[model samples]
Target: MPARFMQMQEVADELSVSVSQVYHMVRSGELPAIKVGGRGQWRIERARLEDYIERKYTETADWVRENPLIGREDEIDPSD
Candidate 1:
């Protein structure tokens, strides 16, 4: 069975981002997480992580719709 909760590192790995980025998300309340154990380690619920991913997908879709590339694709800098 899959884990119901995941460590910050696991969350970062799942999101393909750095652990520090995950920490920042949690600290900024952009991602839902909880402090656990005496050492105050952070753990995010699996459901919450899934929800966050879904929300990001929706946000990205909206952004794409609002910011159409159209003829401006050629104007984009390849090296930025």
Candidate 2:
């Protein structure tokens, strides 16, 4: 069976970000997770992680739609 939950480190590796960044994400309510174990460890549900990624994608698309880049082709030089 697939994993139902993942540790903070696992989430960090999956996202290619620092473990501390994952911790801050959890703390900021950006990602969904639960604190388990006697030492107050974090466990993120695999589905929730996927949902977070999807949400970020949507947010980025919206931002790009709102703020498009403009360029002038004539402003470039052929030789640097």
**Number of the top TM-score candidate:** 1
Candidate 1 local Cα displacement, residue 37, angstroms: 0.8
- Can you write out model 1's per-residue Cα lDDT over 1-80, one digit (the tens) per residue? 89999999999899989999999999999999999999999999999999999999999999989999999988999885
Backbone clashes in model 1, listed as residue pairs: none
Each candidate structure's count of clashing pairs: 0, 0
- Please list the Cα RMSD from the true structure of every candidate, rounded to 1 decimal place: 2.3, 5.2
- The candidate maximizing lDDT is 1
For residue 39, model 1's alpha carbon misses the true position, in angstroms, by 0.9
Query: Against the hidden reference, what TM-scores do the models get?
Result: 0.89, 0.86
Candidate 2 positional error at 4, Å? 0.6
lDDT of 1 at 46: 97
14-49 in candidate 2: lDDT tens per residue?
999999999999999999899998999999999999
